[model samples]
Target chain A: MKKLFQIALGIIAAIGGFVDIGELVFDTQAGADFRFQLLWAVPVGVLGIVVFAEMTGRVAAVSGRPVFDVVRMRMGLNVGLITLAASLLINLITLAAEVGGAAIVLQLLFDLNVSTLILLSVVCLVLVVYFVPFGGIERIFGYLGCALLVYVAAAVHLKPNWHEVGQGFVPHLPSSALYAYFVIGVIGAALVPYEVYFYSSGAIEDRWGTADLNLNRANAALGFGLGGILSIALIVVAGEVFFDPHIQPGYLGTTALGAQQAFGEAGLVLALVGMLFAVGGAAVECAFSGAYTLAQFAGWEWGKYRRPRDASRFTMAWLIFFALAFVIVETGVDPVLLTEYAVILSVVALPLTYLPLLLIARDRTFMGDHANGILGNVLGWLYFVIILGVSLAAIPLMLITNGGSV
Target chain B: MEDKQMDLVYRVLDDQLVDIEGRRCGRVDDLEFDGSLGDPPRLYAILSGSGTWHRRLPRPLRKLGERIFGTGVSGRDVIRVPWEQVEEISSVIRLKAKARDLGLGQGDERDAALVAKLPKS
Candidate 1:
């Protein structure tokens, strides 16, 4: 049971981050416009994430340094500072979005005003974070996020075509403008850069030495791969219920409702629980990643394990950033807007964050005898080009498609 | 000569620095060169802290750092170590300079800058 529980961590972090606001919207949007045509992107993204995440994990385990620590050391202070600021901005924006997401969920459940719920959500997150010990934070957030597996169960209940679904294993793009837009949405979901930062930093915090190298590989390959599966299930459920009816996946209510078509009332409850965990985990991650980037850059003592007094600067940076996100969400800004914007920016920031890991992972000087083997180097370079391509494509697609609106 | 201990600059260049009794000081930020007659040019002092970091920077970065760090301006940002004083380096370090003796007691120099800023309740 302990071994099983330990293995659950990767799935949990992936679910919390992937099934969170950005993904719930991205998958649903693709389901409505393109149906199973975009399903291929899900596994494609799974492969992409698995490649880079494993590299990041291996490098961290071998080097005894987290992602940002290496970035600052190898890339020099100036480039590190620029990337740090960019990553922090993405984290803060995602934090605001998660706060807004939780508020929207409350609005659905209690019939309360979203503004009031936003404030309440902010307070709740802050309190949860305040008493949360460093070691326990990841576990709690990850486990709770696993409740998102309900969407998978619901998709199975819908009895999606086994034959057609298998076809997605091969890449095939639809010629329609709407389907092309959906492909972009899928890429956005699969390659979000924050996942890289959070996962690699987590590896460092746990101090997984070279002995833990296989553990790192297992975590990345299984954990993120499972999250990608959950994402595809969400898309299937949306395709079954909302596709023919012209319903779009824009709000929290609609996403839960789509699952209801398959699993009935119980599905709704599980879906909501999943949403709760997803947002909760994402919130904790973004807020902490914000702090991690800054502390690592300035070479301050930082981590959740350390006391508030010991890591004062790290603690204060996150506390202030969390407060700022709370304030932003407290305004009437839509969580959906925040989520979509965050995902796009996260994709755009992809190459910047991953390139350093790719370079460091393959660098013989840094990794010594433990450097990425031929297979890792090939996969790493493939994802490097893919990430660069997507980052360049993001802004133009956002403008040309007007944020994927057909 | 290999049997004898090396100077802090010669040995600890790009190495982490610790206090006299052994605590983290930071890193070797810059080295002071004092080459005089008849001595194999020994390092006179070692620099640590943002002050030494500033000296190593291009002019623009130095200005930006000065602006952010409140322009105390000069070598005070660093703690210079004379070679005779360094102890040893390992996982942790032992230094010849005490926490207080290395200008730390004046403003508590050896500790982290953020810790120094904290007010006692």
Candidate 2:
């Protein structure tokens, strides 16, 4: 029963932790613009995340080192420094966006000022990070985040033509640059670098070892798989409800109304609650990922599992990250807009992060008997190539589409 | 284990260095060798810290990194752990000595001091 509960909790965390401000914003925009035409991108992105996340988790469990550690080790100082600089910048932007996102949700619920809410969001996050145990943090946000499943219900309730929904799964070129931009956005948002950084480090935090390999695989598959389901549901909800009215959801409140449209007041309340926790959880993830990346790269003590006094540098890193993020959000940049830029830039930096993980996971000296096998290698290289293509094309696509505003 | 021969670049260089208590200390940013040209280069110490990494950078960036993270009075701002002190070489380089014992604790100490000034929970 204990084992079963662990697996179940892992899956829930993955699902709830998967969708952040980026996904909520971009997936909905994709639906509003292309009406499910980009649905294929979600699964493609999910598969890519699962493959690399599994490799990352395996490396952590077996070797007792997280992804960023391997990245710095395998890539050496010069190349590793470049990767760290890029990832850290993207992480800060993502952290700011998530804080801003949580603030927006609070505003939607209470009609509070955005600035006040942003400050409150940062304060709450600091308290949570400082006082809450790792497991407590995961359970509180991960379980509450399940409120987002309301989209699943909302998507089903709005029952559109089954044929059209199925057709969305077929890959096809978009008719315009804007549609193509959403395609890249959906994919980029799904496979953000921070997810891998957080997941692999979380494995080490949990004290996973060779015995936990099967658990790692199950967690990545079920957790991220359910996350993909939520992504698809968000797109479906937007396609069914927003497409008809030509309403583009540019705000967090607009996405919640999809729930209101389908399930009335109850749905709106749940949607807001869900967005609050999901985005809040993402803020924590991004802040921790930044600290983790820096600490790992610099070879400092890290992990919430360690006492604050024992891991002071790690503590300082995260606190500074939150403080900086709060300052950025306080500047009044739109949270959703920040999320768009962060995700696209993250897409451009994807290969720098994953390429080293791919190489290390296959190295016999590093992974020992747990090294990537025939199938893992084939899929790893294939996705490496695919991720490379997306990284190269992300900037061009974003430029041509003018941040997907075209 | 006596007959075991491993490639230094593959096994040691750039690997994470962990203390005996399983705490991470730093990475093997550069290696020091004691032997001359004709002699097989004998590993002397494992070097770590931003200074070591900075030294590895191309000439221009090296100067820039040095300016940002000042070089120590010794002119090499690195924590050098003698290779003899290494307990094992596997996925990570485990040292028999604690970080502070080897003077690798300066960074950790500075950061901890800063954190101690913050309001505690």
Candidate 3:
């Protein structure tokens, strides 16, 4: 019973930590643009995240090292610096968006102004990070985030052709310029770089070990896999309700309203609640990720398991980022546009961080008997190439389409 | 060493330093080399500062560093060590002496007065 309880908690935390603001925006955008055509990317992304997360978790548990530390050791600082700078920019943009999205959730619910909503969101996140136990942070987000299942319920209620949905399962090309953006959106939503950073680092903070390797695998598969299902549900909801409405999803309000369109009052309430939790959870993770990456790379004390002053540098890094990101929102920028850009930049930053992780996890010296097998190596390299391709084209396509409006 | 290789030092030089107790201090931002280049070149000091670091960076980065930290901050001087003092290398650095007791806090003054740094044999 005790063992079962532990696994349940693990699963819950994984679920809560899995989805973020990117998934919320991109899933809805894909649905609005190409209906279920881009849905296949979610599963593809889930598999990719699962494989990488497993390797990263194993590396952390077996080698007692975080991914950033291993990156410096195996790939050297030049490459590591490039990845850090890229990931840092991507994370900063994401922090702004999540903060903004969470505020919007409050605004919709209470009819509050954007500034008041943002301030409350910031304070709420700080208190969560400051006071909540790390274990609770994971589980609360996972379970409360189940509020997102509203999208699933909404999809079921709409009564789409399940056969047609299964047919869209086979990957197909997007037909137009906007089609590329939809594909990018799905990719961006699915294979976010920060997810791996938070997951592996969290495993280290939790002190996972060789004994827990299976637990790590199960968490990655189930957590990310379930997040993938939720993502597709959002896509289905958007496709069923908004595809005929001919609305392109460039804003958060459209997504919120899209859910309301699917299930009326109940749908709006679920979307609002889910958005609050998902965006709130994501903001906390991204802030900590800045601290984790820097401290892991430089070999400083880190993690929420440690008190703030105990990991002074680590705490400082996140606090500084949180302050800067909130300042960006305060400058009155549109958070939705900011998120679109963040997704694009994260696409660019993905390969640098992921490639070294693949290389090092396969290294016998670090991982000992737990090093990657031949199959792991192939998947690692294949994903490396795909991430690079997506990154290289992400910006140019955004420009060509003028932010996907053309 | 090529001057450019010296510049590459700032970027390439960062490795986590741990004391004998395996507690992290910081990165080895700069290396203090014994300039008495009579034999095969000896690395005498491990420097850790922007001024010292700038001397080992690309020209652009060096100038940028200089612009930010000033030339004095990019000074060649660092915590020089007699290469023999370094005990071992592993996941963490294990120095023979505690960092504070060595008057490493006092900088070059104590290192100059007490210990004559010998080149590696």
TM-score of each: 0.84, 0.97, 0.87
Report the C-alpha lDDT of model 1 over A74-170, residue by residue, as the tens digit: 5554566578778888888889988888877777778887778877887777667667665577667777777778888888888888787677556
Candidate numbers, best TM-score first, in rank order: 2, 3, 1
Among the numbered candidates, top TM-score falls to: 2
DockQ of 3: 0.12
lDDT of 3 by residue, A100-185 (tens): 98887788889978997888888888777777888788776777887888888888888888888887788877677678776776
Docking class of 2: medium
**In model 1 chain A, where is the ten-residue run with the lowest total lDDT?**
A9-18
Candidate 3 displacement at residue A81 in angstroms: 2.6
Our tally of clashes for model 1 stands at 2
Residue B24 accuracy (lDDT) in model 2: 83
Model 3, residue A12: displacement in angstroms? Answer: 2.3
Q: What would the per-residue lDDT of candidate 2 be over residues B1-121, giving only the tens digit for each residue?
A: 3457777776788888889888888888788889887999888988887776567788888778888755633324678789998999877888998888877756667777767776661
TM-score of chain A of each: 0.94, 0.99, 0.96
Docking class of 1: incorrect
Q: By the lDDT metric, which is better: model 1 or model 2?
A: 2
Regarding TM-score, does 1 or 2 come out ahead?
A: 2
Residue pairs with colliding backbones in model 1 are B46-B81, B104-B109
